[model samples]
Target: MNTRDLQAFVAVVDSGSMVAAAAKLHLTQPGLTRRVQNLETLLGMPLLDRQSKPLKPTAAGRDVYALARNVLVAVDELMAAGAPDSEPSGELRIGVPPFLSELALERPIDRLRDAFPRLTLRVTAGWSPALVQGIERGALDVATVMVPASA
Candidate 1:
């Protein structure tokens, strides 16, 4: 429910054991266990299969893990953007044709970075079809593609 809980969950998932996760989180094993237990209690579902040797995420756990990752990313972005100076500080996913991505977008991207140093720009270059697909899949917030000109 909280960032700490999500962080613990992610640590456990990544480390594949409470002891390992505890070490990585700098918490006692019991403390890490309590946090995971509390999270499961709060969600009314077990996030990890304790019976498993290396710990495996249940189906619900996988879903919660994915959501938690996104939530944490958003929270970090929010904090960065909320800092004084009113500069953008979040991921801006964009897709562009290969040629434009290499040439046209360079100056504009440079200007954007100069204007907002904290911003993280993610640029994906591809042909028109792939760029359109990226946009449709939400992987890209905006896209520029080339098309045949009509005379």
Candidate 2:
């Protein structure tokens, strides 16, 4: 019925259970269940087969799911089409991990160049601590740093 409802239904289907779906959607289990229930009510048909283990969507749900997915995809493309950030035209300084030896970062860099003709990118490979410091000091615009599990 709505984008949120469609997203909820798709997330539920993709995740395969109310609890898992709830976690994926960052909603409470009962809240997610209510969304699905509400959707069913709106459509006047049960979208999920509650009687089955690892609950599956009903036939109507499948049809709705396909359309909902396509609709969401179209909406995303439409939204992206008008976004000014898509044509980013600024210099960027980013840091990567120092331990990475000759990182295979060219493909993405090439893609960025193709996407933003006027954008300039400067990259520095450094230790996480140094990268974080650079970011905090405004020396680097952005940095990808790995946080050790121990931290």
Candidate 3:
């Protein structure tokens, strides 16, 4: 299967909306749909439940989603290994608690944007526990959590 097709499928599942996924990938909606359909065709099963308000994955799609995430991560690492000095691009998922997001991250985030113009940052704000959970689940690449000083 094509990596682009897998990427498209993962993006669609991640965003839960074709329009959002298409915009994220810089593809037209029709193009995104076709890629996903291509993947579904290869698998011989519908990956998305079209009847839902926001698209959701079918059971097989969930399994594919998990595997695809690992595949994408591995592919990225493999490419990076070959180009040690390559300019960073693609999505960076970050998690921060709402308070920390308000207080500490603005300047650093701005510097990151300036340094890697091609990189897309997708940030999620939540409680520290949930943010940690996100990182563990691979939903977040990195996160900041407050630890008690006494601990």
Choose the strongest candidate by TM-score: 1
Compose the digit string of candidate 1's lDDT tens values, residues 21-138.
Answer: 9999999999998888888999999999888989989999999989988998889878876786666777899888777878788899999989888778999888999988888888
List the pairs of residues colliding in candidate 1: none
The residue ranges of model 1 lying beyond 4 angstroms of the native Cα positions read 15-20, 86-125, 142-144
Q: What is the lDDT of residue 21 in candidate 1?
A: 98
Model 2 residue 131 distance off true place after TM-score fit, in angstroms: 43
In candidate 1, position 135 carries an lDDT of 85
Which ranges in model 2 have alpha carbons more than 4 Å from their true place? 87-151
What's the TM for model 2?
0.56
Model 3 CA RMSD to the hidden true structure, in angstroms: 4.2
Model 3 TM-score relative to the real fold: 0.63
Clashing pairs in 3: none
Candidate 3 regions off by >4 Å? 18-31, 90-101, 119-151
What do the candidate models score in CA lDDT, each in turn?
0.88, 0.83, 0.92
Q: By TM-score, highest first, what's the ranking?
A: 1, 3, 2
